[model samples]
Target: MDRPEKLLTTAQAAEHLGISRGTLARYARDGLLKPTLKLPTGHLRWSLEDLRRQMRELREQGGE
Candidate 1:
């Protein structure tokens, strides 16, 4: 089986993606991004690979 991917907090994710936290949240709200996990307490988490995938998609469309 594959190992589980590392998950990132919102701040870490935003920094990793070179965007501000508000931009990350806006991307989520605008349907441009989705969290890899949404906790029961409503906190968000992201997989590094998923974030990379989203960036690739956005770049393909010139949305980045």
Candidate 2:
């Protein structure tokens, strides 16, 4: 079986989600989404699957 894709950086996650990097940071602050990991450099990363799930949930909730 193919291995799952690795976690993505804030920029990659933002682009994949079709949102701005600041928006992603805002979401993180608002507790709408959480990072999968925090690097030693203090950068945040997220799993593609988790990002997708958050998008779906937002859509279902009528995007607030």
Q: TM-score winner among the candidates?
A: 1
Candidate 2: Cα lDDT at 16: 90
Tens-place lDDT per residue, model 2, 1-64, is 9997799998999999889998998888787887898889978899989888987898798874
Q: lDDT by residue for model 1 over 1-64, one digit each (tens)?
A: 9988789988899999888988988888788888899899977899978888987998899895
Cα lDDT, model 1, residue 29? 77
Candidate 2: residue pairs that collide: none
Worst lDDT run of 10 residues, candidate 2, spans: 55-64
* Per-candidate TM-score against the hidden true structure: 0.84, 0.78
